[model samples]
Target: MEKVLLFFTAASALTAVSSLPARSFYFVYEPKNWTEAQSYCREKYTDLATIESMEDVDILDNMKDLSQMVYPSDSYRAWFGLYDDVSSWRWSMSDSDFYQHDEKEFRNWRPGQPDNYQGNESCSAMYSDGSWTDVGCSYSTRSVCFDVKGPNSTFVLVNTYMNWTEAQSYCREHHTDLASVRNEAENQKVKELIPSTGINWIGLYRDTWKWSDGSSSSFRYWRGLEPNDNMEHCAAIYFQDSGRWEDWNCDKKNAFICQNGFSQKVVKLKLINTSSVDLNDPQVLENLLKQLKQKLKDQGVDGDIRLSWKKQSDGNIFMKNTEDIGSDRDVP
Candidate 1:
């Protein structure tokens, strides 16, 4: 009987193995502006550095070599991934079902408003005239809350003054969520709830900083009085200040840090088929892959594992072995 030698390869998918670190940081001494550094990182690695926690900060702090970098104006700073996204406005109630069509993108900003004054105004507030403006999230103000019952919704004004986050919490605990003004009508409805001269908190808000790799990490380690300027939208790590973060102009050239995640590993496997089943048959090959995946899972292999058969030049996944049949074993 001819022995079919099944050759296949397995690769790691999007999720890396649990034992491996999520990201590895690299400090590049070459001076490049923030945009240039970002492009380089995306081309060579995953993206510019995305510091997720204090541990990541420490890792980067130790990896930086000040002697290798050229001091630009005696500044001991290096660009990382955090950047201000000035147009990322969204509602606090993020459930897609709550909005219709472009209602999610609805805005009633006052003219020349939402300028993100001082680079710290990341929250939205509605005035008595039904216009919205971005304000600092820490500003205490009365908030408008909403209660939804089926398709009907009603706005309520919370008389107690609180910060944006506190108001969101209060509204969530007491009502459906903070008021989401979906249209001119809803904006007017919410505006009516506020006092004629009051600026009240609404569900509209925007994230000031975002990671280059699109990671939603809220971790921040800023130096005192840092990120105080609206023009300085890019973030950098200050080696001289114990690796604390500071905002800078993106156009300024500086040494930068990049991060990389675990790469996909291609593994070759050879299987000796002893049964009479057609090993190259599409259904048979698919079943075999499922069984192999289960076997790997049973043997403690984790993460997203993807298996595919590598067809030879003749377009066949399995070839008849001329040598003596041997026990099943992986080729590499």
Candidate 2:
């Protein structure tokens, strides 16, 4: 009987499922304010539901019990986990080293500007006079690009008119990135580079809406003129309005949704067996699985991990290699 040494091979087949947690939404008919609902969900399940796509919206719509959602008017709603983050504004140039202390907070916005006109203005533009204003990202305009070397930076005005996204791409490809007006001096330098007449796109932008569980989904299914009120900071799905989203006051009590589940991952492993003991034996395989699981835990791998052997066409997990007598193969 030859001694068998088991080792993992480099060509092992490995499959990884998405790390995002699999969630199941539960509709709680009990009316509760946004804050209370959030607390209940956190204590009972994972957190308030974070709908990421139209498919998720449909799921919620199907699961909701409209008869239980009693109200005086025809409108019926349920709170999920979307909210307006009033202080989410920031510059597109994210490199922290490029900005000095308090430079990132510097703002020279024109008065009564950045009202998020109609809840669509998420990009920033610079006037020839050196003031900034929030505008729709789709609006085409001339842009300023900047190049940075060590502690020095140079601002260049792009003569071509383009949307904010296009301008950002052009700037990144040709120069460093869109010009970041860190302070009054940098703002003045960028403003001087612009033509004396028209407004130009800048590096400032923001995403006002966020999920309670901190999901970074940009999906929005708002109804017409929805999110129109600035005072209504929280979001809900209106059942009567074809499940479209609407901004509502956070204090308003309503039924809510909660979600639960852990993220799952799948991995395939191949082992080279050099032991005299049969690797395919049920007792031996179970012991090997236990050892592998313990090893994973010892290495600080969190969450539940399941291990099982992969059976071949002959229903055996371990196969002898006659051509390569030096090694036997086991799939798991």
Candidate 3:
């Protein structure tokens, strides 16, 4: 009997230790800039911490169980649990589910909080008083952690710069629709979908293409010649395109596309501002040429940066550089 009791005690202690969340689990120990930190946390740790209720806050707090709850010594800063100043509070990561407030006992607001100071702040933080304060997305601080929702999670694909009908067709054919960015975290995740290069279409187009869930196109990313007559009511996004969204007519067709497939490459590279602005700026041109040369060299291609600009041709600019377009050759 004595031996069995001792064995039981040892088993219980081991279970407790195994269950205890590591402080390192709360954040990646390596310090990084705000953007890099967010990126690191997303790429390495689980998505930045998301809170569903006060229970989640408590879980995250408990993540620091073994270590002292030390104040951030780097600066007067801390990561928080809110974003986008709207009624919707989102996690910094895109995959996090939208937080739903239920119990009255688990308030996460900072005193005099969520003031929407200048309407630009889209993140939240906690203060010494345990209240949450509005902060900038670029602010660096320790982050909370969260896991992706599930295994069979459905992924949506979008077509940036597509007509509403074409966008709908693309979604139907690909088994998804123009993705609804529910909150900042989702927006953040969408932003992380690809490398920064060109324009990405968002699921936000005027008043049409509203999902069955009531998400609106209130948020917009319009292309240069957009609205094309108020009928261009659908939206889509691509990754290589700097995540900048654009609106398009539902009937007009464009090639820009996006996908959530495991093997699909959904980013579209756009030379939106590749124009050499400094005609006389040697350094700027040199740097641009170097970067461009590196990009070409990295791909191990013999392609050249083709430049096409007619001098004073009715104030119009037309350029073409498509040596690797659709050749199964990636342009780095």
Q: Positional deviation of 236 in candidate 3, in angstroms? A: 24
Clashes in model 1: which pairs?
none
Candidate 2 or 1, higher TM-score: 1
TM-score of 2: 0.67
Stretches of candidate 2 exceeding 4 Å from the true structure: 1-22, 53-55, 72-74, 218-220, 224-231, 263-332
Better of 1 and 3 by TM-score: 1
List TM-score per model, in order.
0.69, 0.67, 0.20
Best by TM-score: 1
Q: Could you give candidate 2's per-residue lDDT for residues 236-312 as a string of tens digits?
A: 88998879989988888899999886444345555556556887788877777776777667856545566666677
Each prediction's Cα lDDT score?
0.78, 0.78, 0.33
Model 2 lDDT, residue 280, Cα: 72
**Candidate 3 wrongly placed segments (more than 4 Å):** 1-85, 92-106, 146-332
Query: Lowest-lDDT window of 10 residues in candidate 3?
Result: 1-10
Q: How many angstroms is residue 287 displaced in model 3 relative to the true structure, after the best TM-score fit?
A: 56
Locate the minimum summed-lDDT window of 10 residues in model 1: 9-18
Evaluation by TM-score, superior candidate among 2 and 3 = 2
Q: In candidate 2, residue 274 scores what lDDT? A: 52
